[model samples]
Structure formats: structure tokens, C-alpha cells
Target: MSLRAVSMGAAYHTAGRVPGPFYRLAPVVAWTVWNLNPAWRRRLTRTMLPLCEGDRARARRAARRALQHVLEYYLDLVTLPRRDMSRFERDHLEIFHNERLDLLRSNGPVLLVSAHTGNAEMAIQALTFRGRSFVALVERLEPRDWAEYMLRLRSSAGGTFLEANFAGVRSCIEALRRGGVVGVMGDRDIQHTGVCTSFFGRRVRLPRGPWELARRTGATVIPIFSSRKRGDQFRVYVEEPFVVEESEDAERDIRAAVERYVVLLERHLRRDPGQWAVLEDFWKVHACGEG
Candidate 1:
């Protein structure tokens, strides 16, 4: 059997046996990925030292432990078990799905801005299962097989997948024009053309895509994040639309929107630090000066 199939089968089996297998699956996956993914391993060493302080060598060791926690969470998400939630997940899903369904029913393009918070992948299922044209801008997949597997998993939403690039931006706009919802992560930096802003009392760059898309397409920018509740349950928080003013100076407008987004994101992260899994050097504000 294929690796993806094996993983899927194991996930289902675990789900049937336990209340939540994601918690268990996450650590194992992270450890495996850490061992296999040399790129991430190097990044972990470089990015983590600032967050942990001790002897330089010891700091790198400590950082690995911290990265493990965050990586494990990522693993849990990639291998999330069947959403056939027990009593706990069911009740919360009802409230969240119902409200989102209502919003989707309305005749307007929506920009669903999400973050890397608790079980966010599940949010796609909750929003799209009932029939809504939703597309997400996904980062380029590495390790061809894993990429293919992610594409299939994401296809559960029944939405088109677009690469995170200019072409993808065009496709997203077109999708929005057709009255579809386009979901994008606004909290993390895209590293290209991102506007620097303050987050968690430090300067960090955020993707300009969502804000620009909203301004160009006139789509309602709605903040949506699904957080794990007590057991299998999750709370999908959907805030009201943010009204962004357009300006002749496009840069100014985008920056203004980014600043507002930073505020909203900061509030959420502070309220639930665990839910916000930003383990990288997110606050490395200034560009390193020339030697």
C-alpha cells in the first residue's frame, strides 16, 4: 500500500480507537519530518536561538525542543483524523458551520483571512462540505509525493488550488469575481513584497495579498480561525467585515490594512498563545546590515 494510504488508514484506525489521534500523530510526524527535512533543520537552528537563551551550543539544543512542539502541531494538522467528531466536536461544529453557511449564502465575494491556529485544516472542511466555492492559496509543495498528497487532502474542500504566485493571484481574483470565497493566511510573511508591520510588540512582515485583493476586488475581509475546544470540539471564530479605505497611494492603503490586521492577529495570539504556532524567527525585524 502507498504511504499516503497507509497514513490515512492508520489515522482512521486511531480516530476510531481514541478521542483524538491528532495529538498523538503530531509529535511522531514532526520528529520524522525534522529528521528528514534538512532545510527545516537548519532553519530551526538559526531561528530558534533568539527565542531560547543559554550557551550558544545549548541554545540550539533547546531550540530543537521548542521546534518539536510547533512541528508536532503541524504534523497533527497534516494528518488530522476523520472529522467525525465525538459529542464535543459535533456541538461546536454545528454552531460554527451554520454561521459560516449563512455568510456563504449571501451574494458577495468574501476574503476569508485565516491564521495558523488550532486545526485550521479542519476549517476548510467545515466551510466547504455544505457546498461553497472556496479556494485557498497554498504554498508550493516540497517532496513531490507529499505535495501530491496535500493537494488531494485539500481537494476535500472541493475548491480549486492555486500556487502562491502571480498566476495564483489572478486565478483567485477570477474566482472571487464568480462569487467564490478565497481563503488566505495573512499572519505569516510571504517574504516577497510583504509589508513590514508590528506584531506581538515586534516588527514582522505580513503578506500583502489579502489586503490588496480586498481593495481590488471589493471583497469583504472577514477574519476566520478554527480553534480546538475541550475535546474534539473546535470554536470557529468569525468576526465582522473590516472596511478598508482606498487611497491613490496603493502602498499607503496596503500598509494601513496590514497594520489593522497585525492588531487583530496580535490580540488573538496573546489571548491564546498555544493556538498560535509561529515557531520561526518571525520578529527578526531589521534586515541584517552589511559587514
Candidate 2:
């Protein structure tokens, strides 16, 4: 087993045996570290400054809270399997615009596009509780064991996982053709072949795969967002789905479709600026160095 697997295994077993109050301390420690760590502070400030409307102080505060929330999110994941499902539903999860989900259920196929903000993993997991199953495309993390461990956590609620790769893309397309739902991240360009678009009054490149896939498969593109309300409680937003408009210029059409999501993503980020968890220099032209 890898080091990460070992650590996660230890945490899982410990959290399972210990009381819930003890698990709560993990976020406290994470928050302190997030504030003290220089590298994390710099990255957070750089990514959040503009998002906070150029307010340096507000950006710094949001950065600290963003890290704290992200850490809390992961801690919740490790202990999720041990929590009571009924209690979780009654006390933790809240769904807004659920009729949109009903629409998705009645529709054929869908491409669920979400950002790095909030507990996105949990959003996908929420579908399982509602008796909906979907395939999520995720980037493989470092240390094979850690990746496997995360994949296990993500699928524990009943969804499927597909690594972000060529084969995974093919599998996603096939699944969509068969009227299956596929969840993908829309905020960052993992493959570096993204299309440039305006976000928060700045230019950033977003992944084109989701839009391209939607166009090819005639899938409805829906924007989903998850926000941590307090402690382990969360609010999930499922927006209406829109079909990508096709035009003679395929590339332009794809860029336009991506721009639409960019607008939606920016709106969500503005609403909950602290929950936006992207750590990269998203607006920098050469951030990816993928020439």
C-alpha cells in the first residue's frame, strides 16, 4: 500500500472507532496550517484576489476559509461511510432546485459540469442517495494508492469513476450515447488544450472536452454546485440544462458553449467566493506552460 493509503486507512479506522467530536478537531488543525503555511497563503491570495473584487484583505480572509472548508470536506469524506445515512439526509444534505434533477431524470442523457468549488465530490455522491447513478471523470492523483483510495470513497455512494484519459473519454462518450449521465469538472484545463474565455473580467482557459462531448452526443449540459453551509452540512444546487448550439464553424460553436459555462461558473464563484477552491494561477496566460 502507498503512504497515502496507509494514512487514509489509519484515519478511516480511527474515525470509525472514535467519537464524532474528535473528528471535528481535524478541521481546526487544517485551518491553522492553512493560515501559517506561506506557500498555501500565496497561492490562495493570488487565486482569490481578483475573485474578491481586488480587495486584498477580503481575498486573504477568503483564502483562509477556502482551505479550511476544503479540509473539512475531505475529513467528512473519510468519515462519511461510518455516518448514519438517515441522519445525514435529515441533518446534513440540502438540495435546491430539485425539480431540475427531476428534469434530468426524465431526460435522456446529461453532462453534469461542475467546478472545483465546494464539495464537488459530495455533489456527485448526492445523486446516489436520490437513486440516480452517473459516471464521473476524475484526474488521477499522485501515489497510485491514494488515487485508488479516493476513487473508492467517491464510488462508495454508488456512482462509477473513470480516469481522465483517452480511453476514459471514449468510455464517457459511449455511456452518454447509451443515455447515461457523466460528471466532469469545468473550471480548469487538466489537459491544457482548453479554449480561452473571459471569467470574472479576466481571461482563462477552460477545458473543452465537456462542451465537445455534449455536442457530439446531444447531451444536455447542466451546472451543479455544492456549498458547505456549516460543519458537515451542505447545500447542493442543480441548475437547468442547456443544449449546445451547433453552427457551421465547429470550433467557434464549442468556444461559445464553453463561454456559457464560464458565465455560470463565474456567477457561482461570485455568490460563494470563499468556496471556490481552485489553487492554480487560473487567469495567467502561461499558467499551464503547455505550449
Error of 2 at 55 (Å): 0.7
lDDT of 2 by residue, 1-291 (tens): 888788778877876456366446756876779767889888888888878899999998888878777766667767767665435555667878878877456547888889887687766665656555688898878898799888887666667887899988999999899988889998888878888766776666789999999999998888888888866778888877898878888899899888888777778887878888666655664243333
Model 2 CA lDDT for position 161: 82
| Top-scoring candidate (TM-score) | 2
Instruction: Give every collision pair in model 1.
Output: none
lDDT scores in order: 0.64, 0.78
Shift in Å, residue 223, candidate 1: 0.8
Top candidate when judged by lDDT against the true structure: 2
The clash numbers for all candidates, in the given order, read 0, 0
lDDT of 1 by residue, 198-272 (tens): 654445567888988988888878887766553445677776677566878989989998888777766665454
Model 1 RMSD in Å is 5.5
Candidates in order, TM-scores: namely 0.72, 0.90
Q: Quote the positional error of residue 5 for candidate 2 in Å.
A: 2.2
Error of 1 at 177 (Å): 1.1
Model 1 segments beyond 4 Å from truth? Answer: 1-102, 230-232, 285-291
